[model samples]
Target: MKMIGLVAIVASLINVSIPFQSRAETVLSARDLFDACTRADMDWISFCNGFIQASNDHAVRLGMACTPAGTTRTHLVEIFEYSAARLLVSQSELGDAAGLEVASAIIGAAFPCN
Candidate 1:
């Protein structure tokens, strides 16, 4: 019985430590930022870099989503936005430009205006 209890406790701890997948993946590093923008196009490199350096401030002003654990919401939002953009970009040949445009629009749209 003691061993079973110990196993259960350990499992619970692991579950708690693992951030929920539903919460979205946070963008933290330059690569992550770049990847998000690049999904739209190679032309977005400069755009992505500029935004990455300015992202924190943007997140603050725009009220981006953040984890209760203190993970910046911008990171997760960026990831989600990037994913949507990439999907559209990848399908541009398939008449996905509108979808990509909408997804890409959301990236900066979430930022709060000061």
Candidate 2:
């Protein structure tokens, strides 16, 4: 069950494109998500928010996180932005980590299940 949830999240994040003669798989990176969350573009900001919400939902459903009731989207975004920034700064390698992986980690850390 946990594996299924993880697979679903991963599938949602994978971007598969088949151009005329080429195939490409583009996955969102932690750095990209961080930039999106901090950017001025509304579209990027919306995308970032959606991604964080989905990640948090998945974590909670999987018993990985226990977010407090009444947590708003804005709060989730703040948590992600702050945590992701610290992680990216301390571990350069995390910049390239899958966005879902980073988001899941942040959510879990901020709201761990007892």
Give all TM-scores, in the order shown. Answer: 0.26, 0.76
lDDT of 1 by residue, 1-114 (tens): 132332333233334443434433442322344355556565565565456435444444445422234535445346535544443354333121222223223333433233
Model 1 TM-score on a 0 to 1 scale:
0.26
Q: Which one wins on TM-score?
A: 2
What lDDT score belongs to each candidate, Candidate 1 first? Answer: 0.39, 0.72
Error of 1 at 108 (Å): 9.9
Residue-by-residue lDDT tens digits, candidate 2, 1-114: 133343344334333322212311477777888999999889988988899999899889878789999999889999888877776776655566577767876787778777
Error of 2 at 23 (Å): 12
The list of candidate 2 runs beyond 4 A from truth reads 1-24
Model 1: lowest-lDDT 10 consecutive positions: 94-103
